[model samples]
Target: MKKTNILKNGALGALVLSVTFGCASTQQEEPAAAPAAKKDTACQAELAAAEAARKKAASVGGEWRDTGKILKSAKKALAAGDVAECIKLANKARRQGEMGYAQALEQRDNDVNSYTVERGDNLWNISGKDSIYGDPYQWPLIYKANRSQIKDADLIYPGQDLSIDRAVTSAAVNAAVQHAKTRGAWALGVVEESDKAYLAR
Candidate 1:
């Protein structure tokens, strides 16, 4: 029994000694991180562009609520030498400004629902007007609305009255804009196949 106890105690002492020595050893120093790249003037042009776009949207009474606030933060970020954050905020502000301008144009005369065609007014030109849809490609909506009187989508008489659609859901509006963007080709007097496909949809 004395021999067994001595062996066990000897083994425990060896383990404790190994653990203490292992913990007492000095650790290696970690490698230092590389310095960040300098970008002093990188976001200057972007900051100018964002400010201009925000002003343009405000001129049209369409400035979004957060656009100015974001631009201010972007300017602060630039002053702080955070080039990436400044550029990102500037880009977001510019896009909001553009969208706000479009919204203001689309809502220009929501009270009036119909347009009397002028001598030089075609579906494309009319739809492109700020008081109308603000996008020429959205002429299809006008065409669809007045199909009972319009035979050729390209031909419209001066005195014809055309109706504007404002009650469409966001999905339908997006679909119309998408179709206008992707339609293949067009002709003057005849209806386009792409138009037909869009109308069918």
Candidate 2:
């Protein structure tokens, strides 16, 4: 009887000890859970920031692969003595590529001016306004096209009438004129296709 009682007391003590240790272990883990929750929140915040950055980057209208290819081909066409074909191909390239070429082309249409050279006439200043042409190197094209009126290509006087061919239609001219006026530049007349020949009015 005595031995049985002793064994029962030992077993009860062991059970009580086990319950105490279990409670202590749970208490210790509670603090660890707070840190884990904080890490999860930080990760969520980082993911949200990454998503926002991705959305912001997408808003920028960048160049497409096809645009580069088309522009290159159009340039090659021009270099190969095909200005008419090059212009057509360039227009097609800009249309096919969806990378804000319309706005650029619209700007190009509007900035046309029958500019008379003032006291200070330099290709740099003239070319600066014509971004589509990109450089003073394109001035030769304008000069060559208007050589009949220009006595000297390099020394255009103050009162020479330089007829700029902005586009090939009245509607195109109007669109260009409107676009230029919006940007505070004087809109010069555009070239139009007549029944017989190209005309400007």
- Quick one: best TM-score, which candidate? 1
Considering summed lDDT, which 10 consecutive residues are worst modelled in model 1? 26-35
Q: What is the clash count of model 2?
A: 0
**Clashes by residue pair, model 1:** none
RMSD of each: 11.6, 18.5
Per-residue lDDT of model 2, residues 23-99, tens digit only? 99999989987865674454444334433333232232223436556556656765675555556656555444433
Model 2 misplaced regions, further than 4 Å: 1-66, 69-96, 131-134, 168-201
Regions of candidate 1 where Cα sits further than 4 Å from its true position: 1-111
Which lDDT tens digits does candidate 1 get at residues 1-201?
999999999999999999887766522222222122334355777778888888777776577989989989988998887879998999999999888878766775563588899998898899898677777977777887887887668889998988887665445656777877887676778878877777787
lDDT score for residue 31 of model 2 = 100
| Local distance difference test values of all predictions, in order | 0.78, 0.49
Please give the distance, in angstroms, between residue 192's alpha carbon in candidate 1 and its true position after superposition.
Answer: 2.2
